[model samples]
Target: MARSLVDLLTTHAAHQPERTAYRYLATGDCDGEVQELSYARLATRSRAVAAWLQERGLAGSRAMLLYPPGPEFISGYLGCLSAGVVAVPGVPPQGRSQNHRALTRMKRLIADSDAKVILGGHEVIAALGRLAEHLPELDGITCVATEDIPDEMAAAWREPDLTADSVAFLQYTSGSTSAPRGVVVTHGNLLDNQRVITERMGHTPDVIAGCGGELFVSWLPVYHDMGLIGPVLNTLYLGVTATLFSPLHFLQRPDRWLTAISRYRPHTSGGPNFAYELALKHAKPALLDSLDLSSWKVAFNGAEPVRAATLRRFTETFAPAGFRGEALYPCYGLAEATLMVTGGTVGVPPVLLEPETGAADAAAVGCGRPGEGVTVVIADPEGPRELPEGEIGEIWVRSASVAKGYWRNTLATRESFRATLPGHEGRFLRTGDLGFLRDGELFVTGRLKDLMVVDGRNHYPQDLELSAETCHPALRPGCTAAFSVDRGIEGERPVLIAELAPEAVGESEKITDLIRAAIGDAHGLSVHDVVLVHPGTIPKTSSGKIQRGASRAAYLDGTLAPVGATAVR
Candidate 1:
């Protein structure tokens, strides 16, 4: 019965003062130097920061929290909650790169949230000062490094009058840079979602206490909802310990993720589908020689479309290291629902749904059933008409964990968050995802927005991308973008923008022919254009979800500078 996250922290501090609540891997590896924060120390630091903010009369305003990957971000985030400030977690400037996408995102978030104060670590604070002219919004804001705040301020900390309805933080959804929509998540949404995650993922007290009550190891960025709400906040909610590191670390060396999991033997650890693929790509014999993942009960994958190939490959590749197929927990959710909406039953292997139409080999991974107290229904995209269990339609959800609405955007809020289905009593949140429920299990097909239509036939971008990827070794997998572009009088035609594997840069012409033939054979659709650019050129969200809309825009604007290209008549 924790009233708020602050209450959970206080209770944990009182009961397990000396228990390690968080461990930060400084070098992003298990063998590297580490930093530990006990529950008592976390409580004290958060209170001290809270008192500092209260003294400055910033308790009720939004504080843009920018921090590199570590414990300081957690402290600042919790401090904002304790002080009743709406925390806007954002990415900090990594270096002197002027055109850094993360820094650009920070500037946009600051403007969108109108955050009056900026709280971050020392390095990021200095980086912001250097880029102040570019970000005029920071001119009127009070910026301070929370790590430098003294401990004596804890004495002045005073709890605010908070209730379930009080706004706790703002989760700004990614993939939209021009008009960032911040989801207004209340304290109730936070608590409810945590409960859903705990029950759905089976994060029970026995599971927690058995793993030394320290069972989460995450490299997902702290700014994303999956990273913040899933591992970080849930750690406080469940009173379990979490090991944290930067996403860059995992990217630099995917082996580090497995190494840390092996060393810690945590009960839960996972990321998006791409993470598993990355680990498999780099899983040399030497890298996984000493690995052991028997204690990993939940490998929750979400924040993007889960791939059946990734699940099969990861489990097969690591089976010798004690990884279980049942551990591959494919979940589904968005920031609007806090984090997890549905996760497959614990200890049960994921189910794959074969295509109900063409492409006999096509299949999609089942996301899972709706969590406890969460109701999910499939409805037609055009109307509120509820579809049958196995029919593809827009996913609708009604849950206590749903956020209030999008901040300051009533139109979008109404369209997405406030929706009344035909003959339904209560409003449901339109997830904008195309999926269906079969035999009480949820399986996501593709995005309603990213769906491509050609010659009056429905085509999913993921299926097209997967076809192109498997066609040739020259194409980089999971780095392709497929969309339909308006071709004047011809109506709309399908276009493919794929990243060329380094070795394939010189074979673009040969690879382009292979892509065209493969796509034609698979879907019987002619590719209007095929542009192959260098790796990392294609746009993606922070969590590495391919942004098809952005790629389409780039193509229309002639900004898709491909290293090599071809056009088919």
Candidate 2:
């Protein structure tokens, strides 16, 4: 296995040092102008960064990379690995008002590692610098600009040898409010997962992928798991060429993702269900008519719930643009597993199934079976028994590819690695997701633990959505949301958010009550907060999972005032 990320770049540099590894697709008058780096160029830059860190007596220490998506991100990451300093990626605070809290998490992570150096672009460097001005723990900050690589930096001496088992980088992920956990990713973990991905996805060593080139565009936030480690790191692993655009670029014009796909003819790319839906909602007819997706081979769909209807409608709409239904690959993964856990067989069509059906119902949409080197089990929470093919169970995965543990939190690490295999020989990673194995294929259900339990029975929010639209013409089917707030020992009470159709904007609460009655009758659950918002008012993450966690946080902080509730806080 390749020891470090630098090794991946170095090997590629040796094979095709002159080939374009990354391309920055511009938006201004320089729209056509591309900023690219050959493997040689990247290695040269990395060496400079390593030497700079060494000169500051911060070599072998941990540092944070807080820059936005660009070649600088690539350089900042690889430079730390090359220098033997642990690399920690910085995440932008989601709650604008809670920026300092986000910084506190970053600060805690850095302090835990005893890291003193921070590497970033002007913006992140500036923000952290200001934070450092008050927090005495933070040390020197280095702005590694792609355009300003000094001559001395280019010729600086390389650092010590890195190994397969050596710690490469630390990836931060969401946890309880009290503590932040970082997934400690090693060089071995990266190399193993990359091999699995490259072999399954069919990226040849000789392939010259365009940087989001030949036909496609992506506006996924570079900070996201799928965005950062999935695409950017995967590109380096297989040596594919791709275009880089900030996640905001797509938010501004989601059509750009399609426009870029149609324009670039990219062989592989895709995001969550919401992205495809957004493109359909935002893109003009003329633009859709002019685009084409036929050249795209692997449109990976995972990270969040993969809705069958969403995939079906997308292929039906984009058919005119040469989008083939067979290119959809519905997969499952999380950062804890180093990215992908189980993916739909690449180059296979997605398996279609009714969302209302739990694992007990089996259907196929051409999403092929699982790959070798991975084992998937559907286990009931009451005990360690595999459910029948059609039974819904918490999806537990055991793989040599699983990550080591969360950094600095051994308790969480132990809890995260409990396995369900017979005799309990080893441990498995609990995904907290629900899915079923059918006809040797996998169909994902909603979260196993996210179900809303009222009285004594269990109810899925999706089922409420699928049934509610029939009761009221104004309510958008499948757009309805149901969640619960803690009510102590009595369990949790339900709340619903249903988006009104464009025509039914006038009728909100009456339609809400009707739908609420329908849901109450069907599921025997009471939805106290029947929020009636516009079609797109509900926020979603880049990968398309409704950020239930973020939404709850918003509601608690008073940013979101549902139909009728006391002001939060």
Q: Count the backbone clashes (under 3 Å) in each candidate.
A: 0, 28
Q: Model 1: per-residue lDDT, tens digit, 485-559?
A: 988788789899999888767888888889889899889999899989888888998778899999888888887
The segments of candidate 1 whose C-alpha lies over 4 angstroms from its true place after superposition are: 96-100, 356-361, 567-569
Ten contiguous residues with the weakest lDDT in model 2: 359-368
Give the local distance difference test score of model 2.
Answer: 0.67
What lDDT does each candidate get?
A: 0.88, 0.67
The root-mean-square deviation over C-alpha atoms between each candidate and the true structure, in angstroms, is 1.7, 4.2
Off by over 4 Å in 2: 28-33, 57-60, 93-105, 111-114, 131-151, 174-177, 204-217, 355-368, 423-425, 462-481, 485-492, 498-505, 514-524, 533-544, 549-559, 563-569
